[model samples]
Target: MTFPSPKAEAPAQRFQEATAAARTALEQLVAQANEAGWGTEEISVALLEAARFLNEANRKDPDPADDPAISDTPAKEQIGHGELYD
Candidate 1:
């Protein structure tokens, strides 16, 4: 089989890396919010939602040889979906 083009492969690799990074960032955001005593539950929920979205993206097209997976949802949605805050 012909090898996949690097142009197509690079983006996928980047996406996977980004998704992994986002997961870590979301966890930190929740922890920080809790420490600051500012809507800890709300922040935790939002971060959880973001993590889910990222996880889904990672699962959709998991090409380990390619780019990292990342969430495709809007930032606002990740921050506001299914939460007491909104």
Candidate 2:
């Protein structure tokens, strides 16, 4: 009996396309910032922050397109609404 060929599911493919778009946008932003006289240190910091934010967001709900090599990790504990405003 022949086994089915492994292939990326539709949701996963869409996720990958979205991620690629985001990365391209980020590169464009960096180029614009550089042309605006933003120093490397400042740009690097902003990019790092953006990466951190994305990481946190991904941890909450990982993209279905993520490679199978990426192991799933437990999501961080969400703060209560009241606690957030406190």
Candidate 3:
């Protein structure tokens, strides 16, 4: 099935700019939420829901790693430069 496209197409730089703007807006939302007395659980839940929405929107191809068992299992190796933090 084909998906519908928006009226305007965003270039790579435009997409990057949108990402940065969304990130900044989300950060400000977190700060406001904290000031409004939202706890860690509430904040994290909101963030996770937002992430899920983004994943659903941006997912073009099937990702086999999202299978039940694989998704639930702990990662044996680092992702990207995970060792850099250690």
Candidate 4:
């Protein structure tokens, strides 16, 4: 597997920045919900779920440059080119 070049790092950095922005926005929404007394059981649960999902996503490792599962062989050289319905 080929590693990513330094040029590829820009997109990852941008994604991290976007994620941080989204988290900040969501935190503001949570605070607003609290101040507005909008925490019904369902709304609270939904908010908790959203927070959990975002936290879990942020905790994950960034995507690796090379994926081991991919083969070096060209696609045309691989088998299984026949029609599926045949």
Top candidate, metric lDDT = 2
Per-candidate TM equals 0.37, 0.42, 0.43, 0.37
Higher TM-score: candidate 3 or 4?
3
Collision count of model 3: 0
Q: For residues 2-84, write the lDDT of model 3, one tens digit per residue.
A: 22333346687667667766777777778888999997579979898988987886685357556566345445543554643
Error of 4 at 29 (Å): 0.7
Q: Which 10 consecutive positions of candidate 2 have the poorest summed lDDT?
A: 69-78
lDDT of 4 by residue, 26-75 (tens): 66776787788876565668977987987786668344344354456556
The TM-score that candidate 2 achieves is: 0.42
Off by over 4 Å in 2: 1-9, 54-86
lDDT of 2 by residue, 1-86 (tens): 22233245698886776677666776777788899999767997989998999899899869847554322422232234333223
Whole-model alpha-carbon lDDT for candidate 1: 0.66
Name every residue pair that clashes in candidate 3: none
Name every residue pair that clashes in candidate 1.
Answer: 12-67, 13-66, 13-67, 13-68, 14-67, 15-68, 15-69, 16-68, 16-69, 17-68
In order, what lDDT does every prediction score? Answer: 0.66, 0.68, 0.67, 0.63
